[model samples]
Target: MAQNIIHLVNVSKNYNGTEALRNINLYIRKNEFLTLLGPSGCGKTTTLRIIGGFEAPDGGEVLFNGVNITSVPPYKRRVNTVFQKYALFPHLNVFENIAFGLKIKKMDKKLIAEKVHNILGLVNLSGFEQREIDSLSGGQQQRVAIARALVNEPEVLLLDEPLGALDLKLRQEMQIELKNMQQRLGITFVYVTHDQEEALSMSDTIVVMKEGSIQQIGSPIDIYNEPKNSFVADFIGESNIVSGIMLRDYLVKFAETTFECVDHGFKENEPVDVVIRPEDIQVVPAAESKLQGEVSAVTFKGVHYEMIVQNNSTRWKIQSTAMAPVGAKVGLQILPEAIHIMKKVTVK
Candidate 1:
């Protein structure tokens, strides 16, 4: 088996009196695109910085290819970072900006030119070598930043929200481009972002963090479909989490109704949280419904209609293609496959 490209065991970081990371343990496979996803101030950036050797840990160690690099300087580490703002020098053209690192390393001019040219082509910036930084658009600048980093042929690329500066459409375009580039080059990429959609769309594995600790780590489907806790369910996507009591191995009670969920291992009568996405709720005629509700609001979404339904005691959000008039009675149904049962955790 191939060795893991990056590893962090029991790693923690503290600033002043506040802990920024808490006992992080992870192993990143070679040539994989892994994302550190979480809300702002959730230690995602801290983890990236620690791996990049920009910040040292308070305890534990960081390893690269089984080598302990906990104390390695940033420049000596086989990693390169691309910041959100691109950070290219306005006075320097694309070629100079990308060739700066190799120049500092005293690489021969011929070698630098060859490497820079290849990277420019790799990032789709081949013809922009002499273009000034200020003369490019946000997406163009981002490409230049990526090209500059890849010019060094680092083992891993750390992108700290490199697409955050672009407009929505451009950002979406770049996401696909970035994924394609990673696959084509077969290089490891460690991306940090708070954008849940981006994480879901691009990551091979995702580490979800909150309050300086990891909430969950898994594939996009595992994190989205089988969230281990209420926080993970609520953070990764839009979920309607309802408090319920486990009746048995497969039965749960919520709002005076017993639901058959395909989840197990809960003690009888234990309080659990059930999560169902908006799109998972099926809307049917009042007389044929399993879960009856009253329509409180309805809005047209180009592809589907979003309806807010209330069960007199609780409001539930639902999405459907069938339009329902506001103030009408409707029945809500959640398939067994859509119900996610999780044990709730008290926030510290």
Candidate 2:
């Protein structure tokens, strides 16, 4: 059984009357890469800070390995954090920066040296020990910051947008590297980021938060394919959310057309939101399409093509393998598996 390394029970945080997190109950499994994903102003970072002991919750308790550590100070917790800015000391070299933590714990010089060397190698910075901090590229400096955090052997490592500063290519590379390191070390990683692709690519469990509330918690595939709500479906990937009426258990009506879907459990004539991912759409010859539309615009995105199709005044974004020229009559076909119907939430 996977151990629950960290548990938050009825956790709520408030700042001057503004609710930052509302009754958050979460259990982080041992060695699992849990990602708290959302856009800006979401409670992802707030929750991470609370878990790291950087911020205290106004209510509830935090348990680490079944031991209550709600009131524990930052230094007392077995957690390390990597911020967006590489917080390395400008005056210290790479080696001394990593050794600073171990030295404070009063570890012997020989042990510190050995540990630092191993970590440097692990982070692929074996020969840059004596190099100046400012001499490294953005990616290298970021790796050093990660090395500093991991060197302490913390049970949980909290990373808040660690790769946010790197370029696109570097970010992709680091994502794989970080996952590999996490698996090899068997340390739980709690990552906070607004990038949906990052969360989907690396996380074992993704907790989608919004406006101080938990929206959904599920695996990458589940969040991408079967979003719990309209916000989740739209936020996790490129989804076209259309208003639909449930006509039957496996059927919904959209855009004056009744279509078959896989979603069940809905009353007849219930208002719902149908989510169809762009990649799930198939474009056929106009005469062969179930839904006919004219291609409004087309843009080549290197590997695949992106096209905008228009039916009346309603527009739909389609990504397909077969490149369709602009002004062409195209038939848009969405498979039954691609249709995800969610009950519309009525706002007061």
Give me the candidate number with maximum TM-score.
2
Residue-level lDDT of model 2, residues 1-348, one tens digit each, is 899999999999999988999999999999999999988988888899899998999999999999999989999999999976778998999999999999999999999999999999887899888999989998889889999999999989999999887899888988998999999999999999999999999999999998888889999998987799999999999988889899999988886777898888899889999888888889998887668889989989888899999886457898887888889998888888888899895673
Total clashing pairs for each candidate: 0, 0
Candidate 1 error regions (>4 Å)? 106-118, 121-126
**Each model's TM-score, in the order given?**
0.94, 0.96
Instruction: Report the C-alpha lDDT of model 1 over 301-334, residue by residue, as the tens digit.
Output: 8999999999956788888898888988988887
Estimate candidate 1's alpha-carbon lDDT, on a 0 to 1 scale.
0.89
How much lDDT does each candidate structure score?
0.89, 0.91
Best-matching candidate per lDDT: 2
